[model samples]
Target chain A: MPNQEKIRVNQLTKVFLKHKERVMALEDINLSIKDGEFICILGPSGCGKTTLLRILAGLEKSSSGEHQINNSGTDRPLQSMVFQEQGVIPWMTVEENVSLGLRMRHAPKKLINERTKTYLRKVGLTPYAKLYPKELSGGMKQRVSIARAFANDPEILLMDEPFAALDEQNKFILQEELLSIWEETKKTVIFITHSIDEAILLSDRIFLMSSQPGTIKEEVKIDLPRPRQMTQVRSDPNTAEIFLKIWKHLQTEVQESRTKNER
Target chain B: MEELKKAVEVEKEDLRRRQRSKKFKQILTISSPLFMLVIWEFLSQTAIIDPRFFPPPTTILQTLFSMSASGELFEHVRISLIRILFGFLLGVIPAITLGLIMGMYSSVRHFFSPLIMALMPIPTLAMLPIILIIFGIGEFSKMVTIAASVFFPVVINTVAGVMNIDKVYSDVAKNYGANPKDFFMKIALPGAMPVMMEGIQMGQAIALLTIVAAEMIGANSGIGYVIWMNYKAFLIAEMFVGLILISFFGYLFSLLLRGLQSKLIPWK
Candidate 1:
């Protein structure tokens, strides 16, 4: 028998109207993610990857179909989203930003303080805990965002291009740190990014999405070993082979999307 | 490589020049006011302007000292401060609350915008005669005039502050399951605070201006009353003293507000 399902989606669709034009952002999307799986959703811009992630995090209402968490109940699941822009509040200190979710839940002060310190240490931000967001660098701010989600101890972590703004060095370091955190916690992660290399390197399974009225066109499994490094992955011929395979599917969808828009 | 080395040296020298210029600018910024004061003193002592009409800085300082020794200056300042505090509370608290409500909801704002626009430009001081007739020339009229004067900017800026907050912050807060109170305290208030503080500072300055103007019309006690009394008596130095006190108090109030703003919104 298959392992217990962590999240299930049934014919999920999202429709939005922009400038008086009806746009279907996602259509007939059905997906099921297993427990402790790291799934990356890869798509072109405006392809509804973020929209799908938002729906999973219960941040957006879908136009149709059902989403169930852990096959447990209809209630919303415990999840946190790390936004593309590293949505750390500028007015708050690193510790306060990390502790915000706990504060919202009215967790005990002792518990919040302990978890905040733990996550700050994990993200290597303990030295700068008292500093405000404006004082931090872009990479450090994103680290704070990641620490905040981890501090929440959610059953699922949704990341929308969390490292999109950082330089290559910082991105690689954060990717490694994220992997370690996932290994320790085994929290199901739904990461959204447009970079195929990042998806192939970080995810256990990659869901390639087509543009406009986005649907999953392919789900490619990377049987790469755990504790993977970027350098090793790049050197592996299989990585480039899989990347081209995904790109081939993506290119046709991208062309069709452009052609349809031109009309 | 030689060109790059020369360019780096030139850049370093340019940075040093800029640093020196900034230091010189700061020194001039502090001393220019004192330099003007000395010039005014020299001109007045040399009889360029009639001392009777335009008292010298020394004479004004002497008058200030005398007023201080007698405790009369303190009495006027205390009374004026009390009036301002009372009026500012009355004006600012309600304006901020209502402005925030209007800012959060478009329908509410639309309903009130016409009335606000109609009333805002009527000049609160223009109502002094009517206010005096109703509330009489007592503290009540003075306080009401000050409150009315300060109300508009406080409401307008607060509304702008709320409207200008990034929707992303609010959306994140909602996604995290923040309730109304949490939303306001954590997301709304801090996000709007810099602008709100600016409004409070503006309201405070306007309140002080209104109090002095209102006192000039018919009042027994504030700095304005003293100025009017001394002007009628032809005590030019004393009138200068009152003018100086007003400027000093306004400057000090602004300095205090600046300190408060930095303390409250350090990130900004």
Candidate 2:
């Protein structure tokens, strides 16, 4: 059941009209994701990692090819996305923002209340639940986003650099919080990040992508033990090895991209 | 422990500074206008200025007090208030509805944007002649003109408010599988509300200003009528009473609106 195929992408392509010129953002992205697998799409800037995630979230249509998220549960949503910024609605209170996904789906009151309570507590936001998102710190707002994503109970959670804006301390804490929740819920999550260490810490597999015609360059399976803590992951010998691998791959691509732009 | 004590002392000093500043501000706020009123009373009592045109503060206050006691001011204020309230509701309801729709749909925006652009420039008072021709110089004409004034500001702000909602919110809502109804009510209305409230406030001010002109030009029963009648009869003090009353109500209504705005969207 753990290895059951939850997502499949076959030769998926995305082309964008930037200033009226057709630029290929993602070309023939193909991947098979197992149920409950944690995926990190690692890449340099403009590597089409976010575009792929947005496509999966159904926010944008793929130009060609196809992808599918198998929703086995009758009523559960297929997916929910945590945006990199402005994820929490400013006008809504923390409780309201967290309950947005469930309430939008018109879930029963008891279920909404129960899940909202559970997630709020899990994210350590029980005390701030009644406050508006505007009153919260940047770290706290991201907590609301994470809680809302988990509380939705979607088959898949798509996070596009959810902790990228956080400082080291807050990011480390939220990353741990996310990992613990993922371990308990066993939900499929595809997190996009540029930080090699972060990808190593959270991912079951890292999909390295190349720039320009963004395509999947390599897939690295992480054999790190479950329940990862930041300190232990940083100290792990294997982590350093994998970091070097991703860094080496990313270096050439990023350099080529910067040089090409310089021309 | 030394650092903690230093921090607490710093905090106490900051609080004291803030308290002193707030007290100074309070005193200045109450005294600034009172100071002006006393100077005006002094100048007018000594006949430094002609009392016929520029009446003393006491004379205006006496006129206001006399009119209120005789129930004449009450009648004029009541009629004017009713006209403004009706006109505001008539303008706000339609403008808000159209604005929300126009904001969400580009086709609607495209169609109406030009029309609004062309029409918004024409002064609401300038339309009074046409309004009088159409509605025939009664309470209806005054209401229609006031409504016209109220419409533009509310609609423009409402549209801008809705259109300015962050794109990320729409993406998040779509990902969550929100239906159209939920999108409009939860996202569109509330997202646009803070800006929309600004429009509503502006609309209230324009409505008050327009209602006076409207009553002076057409209706015979409002505060504007009293002002015009007093001016014609050379009752300058009575005219000052009407002007003062309008200003007082404008201040009162804006305060009420500010309270409503805070209650409605405290998050903003």
* Predicted structure with the largest TM-score when compared to the true one: 2
Tens-place lDDT per residue, model 2, A92-164, is: 8899989999999999999999999999999999999889988898899999999999999999999999999
DockQ metric, candidate 1: 0.53
Best by DockQ: 2
Candidate 1: list runs displaced more than 4 Å: A71-77, B1-20, B129-137
Q: Candidate 1 has what TM-score?
A: 0.92
TM-score of each: 0.92, 0.96
Lowest lDDT sum, 10 consecutive residues, model 1 chain A, at A69-78
lDDT of each: 0.87, 0.92
lDDT of 1 by residue, B179-222 (tens): 88887678777887889889999998899888888777778998
What does the TM-score come to for chain B in model 1? 0.90
Candidate 1 collision pairs: none
Candidate 2 local lDDT, B176-213, one digit each (tens): 88898899899999999999999999999999998888
- What is candidate 1's CAPRI-style docking category based on DockQ? medium
